[model samples]
Target: IMHLPFRGRLKLLVASLTAIILLTWLYLLAGNLENGRSLLLSPCLSETPEARVLERVVLESRVREMEEENRQIRLQLNQLQGTVGQPADGGNYGNAAWGASADTGPEDVENTAEERANHTECPRSPTILKCELIHVACVCAGHNASRDVVTLVKSILFHRRNPLHFHFITDAVANQILSSLFQSWMVPSVQVSFYDADELKSEVSWIPNKHYSGIYGLMKLTLTKALPSDLTKVIVLDTDITFATDIAELWAIFRKFTDKQVIGLVENQSDWYLGNLWKNHKPWPALGRGFNTGVILLYLERLRRIGWEQMWRLTAERELMSMLSTSLADQDIFNAFIKQNPVLVHQLPCFWNVQLSDHTRSEQCYTEVSDLKVIHWNSPKKLRVKNKHVEFFRNLYLTFLEYDGNLLRRELFGCPSQATSESVRLQGALEELDEDDQCYDFRRERITVHRVHLYFLQYEYTPAGDDTDVTLVAQLSMDRLQMLEAICKHWEGPISLALYMSDAEAQQFLRYAQASEVLKNRKNVGYHIVYKEGQFYPVNLVRNVALRNANTPYVFLADVDFLPMYGLYDYLRHFLSILQLGCNVTKCYVKKSRVLNTFQKHCMQSSSKLLLTHLYTSLSPCRPRYHVWTKGHAPTNYAKWRTATTPYKVEWEADFEPYVVVKRDCPEYDQRFVGFGWNKVSHIMELDAQEYDLMVLPNAFMIHMPHAPSFDISKFRSSPGYRYCLQTLKEEFHQDLSRKYGAAALKYLTAQRNI
Candidate 1:
């Protein structure tokens, strides 16, 4: 039942041929008869035994050929039917999570949706577990839609009290962007899926206009086709709308719906629907003022049963016949359909969808309503819309945009002081992956530590920012606490520190932190402890612990032994905020040499390091010591860095372990590199494999406080077997990366060899 013409006709051909073949066989089995009730069994009896056998064999061969033809035709029919799968239970999803089937063909999208109208047997993922989820759908087709979608979703999460499911009708670019965001969020209440917008638009030869993605907006009408048919009801929204109250209250309105009302909406406050916005202005036909499609409570099941596909398409083609393209936007199509079928539309309160366009007489709704439940920026001008009270709505949106979603976390723990380690549950329980696969065996053998005790203790509790987006993340051993205050003082932002220590060492550190002027009672710094259970230091595990716990939008992954330069935190924030949404950062941090080998340059925020420089034309007191420079830092290009004011790109993704100020959603550290050697290298290599652009920030620098090598490093250096194991592990890692990336892995090999 796809919109495939040839396939439909081919099915008809098969049915007609089958009927004709049966009739021919029936006639051949009987002798010819002229009169009614005459005997007709003479054909088989008149034939000799050998002749009968030969005739039967001939018929069997012909039948076999016809069956083969039928089989080939059936295969072609199947090729036309692509995936339309449903979401599983609202909890824990793997590769086949949400409503998206892992097996859905990317290339098999149709021009116009046929929806397999009579498909009584809906396909669902066998692995999906079912639980209740509040379904929400959005049409996020273009670039800016992702940003708007984030704020829209953020507002929902901030206000909702139930588990959420999102069905995004999006393009390839937006899908990748939102996917990374969703993964990083890890909100237990949220689930997201992507449907191909390009797939639905693939065969369309023309469009209404470039703005509003033309008919892409109208694609919401195809929700039954785009989303899981099993999802009976959903609230569809525009990315530009923000809810000001608990979504549960809005959801409860469904109880007020009559049996015939399939779609719920708020009537338009704009005079455009009345054809009075401009002189000679003509608008789409509607019952009184048209209803806004920005906030919709769609009854998907009722829509499917009502022949929504045929009704909408026929209505759309009829409307478009007289015009070149639609100007009223996608809402025009909905308004047109609802004009004639008023029984199917349910009117919601105007407060649920308060409009803010100049053409809209929005003040009328404001006067009638006591509260603003939802705000819609339906105009193309958005914030610049000509409404009397636009500033209030604009600020409301900006508040949600700047809101730190971390504070909305569902989990809150209150551990009593008397609870002993044995009595308390372990934080971040390790998954016992089956060792049946060689890859799984390799990981288990290499990983010596697993438990991540997040926020084991806190010296102070600090909010994310008055308005900031960066969190500094570092990992260290108990012995390396010398510059904790210096680093904390240097960066006046949130810092998440992961330390490898015993229970006693953690208590000692917290007591010490409490007593210090710079560190004591500092609300901005979070301490996570990974207890050393007599195992070689799991440095990457510690790094992952800190990175995962960072609750800010951006994180600066530096070493605990390093101090950031003055103005670097604010500069990094300013730099990231202006970066066209801080996209595709490959070189997120500047690579600076160790302070032990170079001049010690500190922050102006606390104190500055005075240094005597050798030959430098610039005013910088800090300079790189070429004579004592470490290996693998040649990629940082210190010579270019000395004079360049602009950021530079590092061609290699691996080997160059530069400090990074990356988004909190970055790829996690490869925990397989438990000790020290390739932990950071493997992370950057994976980033490179994902094709992220690495750039070296010009002003950012992490002044490393050089110290004696750790016990793990000493062991790695002194023991030959340990070195051999690390080498074998490195090779194994490369092999796995090769298998995952195929020929792309060869480029990494080339880069590694060059390094």
Candidate 2:
């Protein structure tokens, strides 16, 4: 700068200084803008080798400082938000700070505190997007509790994938234990809270106490009020239960209930309800009417609509209470309520709540444990002991507690690794027992005739001569000896009689045959006695054995008590001869049959056709009978009988009995069926399964004798063993047929009867 006046010199110096300052500021701003652009382009910072080395050296210290800062910020935030105070009962429902949602408001905060004070617990706010929230409840308060709350919780956690909020209604001691256990476990998405049963008792004080044990029966009644009001549905489980499948599957049952159905439960599998609770109640079976409440899906909204308090009040009403048994207090009341309003109940599959003890007693109804969703240890003995089924479940319970992933997978989802071999052996042994017990005899004992006996006093015999192509097979038991004598004497064709008896009966029959003068003279009659030891009379097996012995192409499966009329054998021989000559007939049955009681000798004396016509006319009020041969004076008119044989099509399930005539090569009778109920039914069902055609004879019939019904037949409905055997045989028949012909076999067997 140039020398000037003092004022001008001062002004120039100030201007120069101000320009320098402004220029410096612009340069710094440009540099900062470039750095910002770089940062935006390169999101991840790149460091030089020296910078990386410096970072590695101070990483731990820097992390500590950052964590401390975060902790201070969280502490400040928590202080501002206010601490979630402990519940009044000293039980923490969940991690409150971590579970509080962003949507939580001041009202929600106040409500949460109030809920804690009221001793009512709520689930944590759902964190995961689209995750389903399921609420489950259970009561554990009794001296007989073999399983602790931990085992029950573990079972639920092991199987469920969706978020679960468990409400454990229990005593104070169990509440503390469960709260601590759940806190220590800290399972994600699974929050549990313990509700004191005392709280439940206080809330439901209006309910009349029927001296009910603890809160076992009453907890379910108060569930609508006890659980958080936000929940719409909850699955109620017994503490004795162990889950085998995802509880979400059970929770989904709420979706299936109709508008009118308030609860979904399984029927009691055993007759315990029928025998003990129902007693003499009509319109209800022992097993089907009552539902087992071990596992129930409660629709809280629907239950509330029905007035939960009203249910409690009904228990106090003597007239209504008397309709139920106090033995199963809540269960009986629920069943009685359902009985009056049947539409309020939806029956779940028995697989959901299988009563192990009940299934064990009736092994026929036993479902394998692997297939079940929940196994209820109803029997106290089962929990305490190490039996075949009980031991495996106990070990599984322990594995769940340990959280042994590998062992739990093997025991829970898969079959128990340890039980595999034992189960296989047990299964094999059971199959062997089933085989041995199914028929008259398991041992293939030789059948031999001790003597040949016959009675031909009222006979007109026309021998078959050289045409010995037809044979009659009849199965005889203790009561049909006279009927057998008449059949053997009257039939003029080849006959094979299978005397199905025990050893003692065979000895008596042999002596009786040897002393008979009529039997020794008849060359056409032959007797084969099969001796066996069994509780049930295997009539079908004997019939099959007798048919197998016949050498003829055509065989007649006749009842030993039925006497073929005069021209039956002649008509059958002609029919078979025609069939053998390409008539395309597989079976033929008599359209008209006569049943002669002990006092009705006139039926046997009259013309078979005339006898049927007279009987049909005499019994005017009764509809004409078909398919079954009953012991009565009922008959079919000759015109109707003749009209019935007018080339009608024979369905697989046609009522025509196999007693008429059939090809020897037809499907043999199933021998697995035991006792008298299914002897004839099984044979007919099999014939139907095989799609064989049966025709009715136009002008022929047989007369059944007047022997008294056996003890097995008369007491069939009253006997348990008999009923069991009947049901077992029916299942076996369906299974055998289905195995061979697929499920369509059942349709074939049940087709409409005609011809």
Candidate 3:
């Protein structure tokens, strides 16, 4: 029987005995754990001291080897599972799902998101009337995590057939983005609520888990507490995965769960739990193969009835005595509990998870499955996974990654009484158009006017007033986006950028943003789009849009043409802090806790001046109000400002057009003023009327870079009708301010003849 030398044969025999003894102990450990007894107390080991010592040596050796392997694979495991200890920027975590081609097999599977989302392929059920929601939940953290979450929601929306409710456990940044995103999409049948993960952190903070995802990953275990008590069932998902089929079908499995079965999970498709990855591999014990926690269907009421918290907590405590800290966090504990309480688990079909890890043996799952339901690239390599069929999955995921999120906004099926979606309304109106009309401009005017599509949902949120952060809020046309890099560099703070342009310009700007180094990578910038829907530019409307969306307490409302002097942003924050100025201290809520915000101008005592370039001197000043314009600039008294070390108040002058940092709730610009003349003048006048200090800052500078005139400015100079309308609007504005404040509004200005 021995082909090898005598020593080699002896070594092989020794190794075989070692494997047998290890497996035997493992078998006893698994059985003993099920009976709530440690392997140390097993009768097979005997009550003898020698057997106890042997058992200790074997078990200790196993745990040490496993820990070493875990340390080596922690990073790889985190990426594979779609969760990371640190928040990645735009592209780190892969947001994709494997899409195996359609194979002929048995059909009629059902899954989708219903009840809280607007679905187009509405099932003939009374989902809308009965409000039968397919409630889904996700645990998300980090700044760019929303990118994956967005794709996950898109997949749900893509296959959903009824009303859906989304429950999100998120940090502040994620909550801000998701709340704003869903609000802007305005999907009729969908509703989403956010629970702060930070608030739930204390629930799991006591657990000593060393999983690569850290405590954020443990948030899943606290789902029964984090979610509302009324939420009886929820389909929990990780951010890295996307559903290839209807999620309603997955939700349908909850009805299939037995009274004792509280959690539905897919088995680990890889041979990981079989201890075959390596001879020394001693992963957490699982039944047959382990259970993956990436996608879970929880029967919340059942879990609570079974005292899930106490049961799992006791389980974690017991495992921790020997394992120290879990290697897989929630997944490990879940499997450990399932091992002890087998009846509590309901296994879902492998098609639902479709795990695509490097060591995956999920190919057996592909046999006769009609459609690839949920393709989990549960590997760090993602699209570059070792699988030969990865390209097909890559292409399918890219389709959704580059998808136009705007297209997902469709009319809610089963809600006939509600207003139609833009597509439906536009399609209906287009039928009324002349058959000969093929011109782009004619169709745009008729179709686009029916939809109010100005929104900027692309933003990250940190809770307001977490610090004394100032945001530069500015408005510009798409032509001026090239100036974004310079301004973003010099200003050195977050920004709220609002643009008024055509739809084509918006698309062009998006492409430019993706290609540009600064625009693409920067997470602090928020883009608000207002396409050119009207003839003359609504300059005030654009300004108001930027100001309203600025999350910071202080907003430096400047024209896009101007760049703040370097370090002016930090300087303002410093000056404001010294003066104890708030962003006007408004009350807002963060998970029911109060947050305070302040305005910038409320504390404008920086040791700097609001400096402007010589662009004014270079340009022709042949307008009718030349003296008033020059006099407004002259009021700063630069003669003293040049040597001054502190701020001095400047009496508000008519036509001043001041560029100042103000609070969140600053005066709104007059909507009545369109095109060029008196647009800024009316806003400054309103600020004066409201008594916000117009202080002259020393050493601070606002440089007006040279730029071509806007379309409205060019029109104002040539068209007499445009000039006439401007004059009339100015007259009415002055008259109205005079009526409201009864001449006190004019108190701040040096009165002059009408232009």
Question: Which of 1 and 3 is the better model by lDDT?
Answer: 3
* Per-candidate local distance difference test: 0.65, 0.56, 0.66
Backbone clash total for model 3 is 41
10 residues in a row with least lDDT, candidate 1: 84-93
Q: How much does candidate 3 score in TM-score?
A: 0.62
TM-score of each: 0.46, 0.36, 0.62
Better of 1 and 2 by TM-score: 1
| Pairwise lDDT winner, candidates 2 and 3 | 3
Q: Residue-wise lDDT of candidate 1 within 23-113, one digit each (tens)?
A: 6755654333232111433566537795466446555655676679968864663442111111121111111121123322332112001
Q: For model 3, how does the per-residue alpha-carbon lDDT over 1-755 read when each residue is reduced to its tens digit?
A: 37899999999999999999977866676445422346545586557897666556656766676679867775564474342112122111111011111221122011111211233344332222333677888988755566567767877887777677889999876776677667656565787889999999988888777776789889999999988998899999988787787787788777655455688888787777778898887777675577888899999998999899999999988987877787778898898888776656777766778788787866655554355788886787777877656776777676666555556667556554234365467668777767664332223342443112323334654754545577888888877878898887787688888887654565577678878887777777887766465466677777777788888877777777766666887788887675554233442221110111111221223223322212222332321124434644555565555566777777766676767777777788886666677777788778777766667666566555656667777887898867775666666677788888876866533363533
What is the Cα root-mean-square deviation between model 2 and the actual structure?
26.9
lDDT of 1 at 172: 68
In model 3, the runs with Cα more than 4 Å from the true position are 1-131, 258-260, 362-364, 367-370, 377-382, 387-389, 402-407, 416-471, 475-482, 493-554, 570-656, 663-665, 669-681, 706-753
Score candidate 1 by lDDT.
0.65
Stretches of candidate 1 exceeding 4 Å from the true structure: 1-132, 202-207, 368-370, 411-427, 430-755
Ranked by lDDT from best down, the candidates are 3, 1, 2
Higher-scoring candidate on TM-score, 2 or 3: 3
Instruction: Estimate candidate 3's alpha-carbon lDDT, on a 0 to 1 scale.
Output: 0.66
Badly placed stretches (over 4 Å) of model 2 are 1-431, 434-468, 582-602, 619-640, 644-648, 654-658, 748-755
lDDT of 1 at 17: 100
